[model samples]
Target: MGALDVSKIVQGRQGWRLITCIWLHAGVVHLLINVLCLLFIGIRLEQEFGFVRIGLVYLISGFGGSLMSALFIRSSISVGASGALFGLIGSMLSELITNWSLYANKVAALLTLVFVIVVNLALGILPRVDNFAHIGGLISGFLLGFVVFIRPQFAWINQKRVAPGQETAPVKRKHKTYQYILWLAAVVLLIVGFTVAIVLLFRGYNANDHCSWCHYLSCVPTKKWKCNSSPQTCTVMQQPNTLDLTCDGTGTHHSYSIAGATQDQISQLCNSLCS
Candidate 1:
């Protein structure tokens, strides 16, 4: 099956992929890592806020990450719920800050969450990792945390204090107006970012069909043919030579030599073509 990719998202307008990509993964390892993180973070969040808000955090944060990834990452068919997971982590941090008065051990909670975020973000700097999505989801989730992760008032009140019809005053909603403005600002930025990316994509800006300079993933620097060049033709170190293909009235001819062609490429290509 075709992967959820930027080409389809932008050029084909498959807007659903922003969320759908979270459900895809490169391999079993990718899937398992995401599942573990989701389980750890999701379970806690679900118990606190229920499924609805947690689900919103996952999806909205995933979309935020994917949108940003699409804007700058044109060559990869990125898949994984890392963005969504990171969003949960981000929202957890913001939630702690917004509800600082509620937590029994605010310092410990903040430190643990901060340590998790730092380690994950540090790992993202490795090759083949996507840090952009992490940052995007993080920002989006942090802003959204203010709006979605409202502390339950009843949970904060003393259970034994109630004797009769007397009502317990709910915890003061400490969410400042500036915090809400920040949330709105995040939403506006996301909308504008997506709109501009779509416009640029339609205006003829596209990753080269082969993504020649993108990375080893985009063009597997092997003895293969690509647009206007062969893998061997790339001015890279220790690149082997290519096989010669000639067809005339006489017959098809294939030539190989140690100088230009390696034994493996010659054997493989010859078997595929001549055999």
Candidate 2:
């Protein structure tokens, strides 16, 4: 019914709800948009890489998208398959980019699709939409497709038989160096992605006003009647020969003497406040 209710359903008790939530849309408009995009991209990818492989790519990419969104946008509620759809689009683009000679004509079509989707994604930066999740899904899908789907090159060896002047060629092994490189790159990207997600999770959790040390050292003291009761209060409580002690909302006190402290000392004080 509401965002909170939906969040509860999506978050669930054990967190398995994320998988279903991605498929379940909040409204008709949301369902239609995501379904249309999925149909367009999924059909093309299935044709190229068979149903099973395409399904795998979609599932993994979707998981990556949801994981990123959960880590980064903690307070917001999201439900859509757009992230997976975008992943399919990214896979198609990567395939075309890697083998341009084989798909020269298709490049124009792919580029047109990318342009349209990118414009739509750009619009998402305004509010509601989890553009970050879309981006994570797209990148993960592209990387997975590139790493797993490319054809390998094989070498042949010739052998001669003395009996009847017959010659045969021995099958040679295919090299997988390129695939290994791709996998390595994917791992690196995923690691970086998760790190960003962690950073975003904790961002803006505590406002600057909540830190008494910062208020004491950085914020200018005000003499207004309302200032004393406010969190901005920075009055010195004790005067030592070398330093001045101060108190704020948090009883933890700090000492300051000079007009300004060194960068390292300021950093240490801020860290203590946060801790």
TM-score of 1: 0.64
Model 2 regions more than 4 Å off: 1-13, 106-110, 152-180, 187-275
Tens digit of per-residue lDDT, candidate 1, span 192-216: 7657755765463533322423322
TM-score top scorer: 1
lDDT of every model, 2 decimals: 0.65, 0.57
Per-candidate clashes, comma-separated: 0, 0
The deviation in Å at residue 225 for candidate 1 is: 24
Q: Which portions of model 1 miss their true places by more than 4 Å?
A: 152-161, 165-275
Worst 10 residues of 1 by lDDT: 227-236
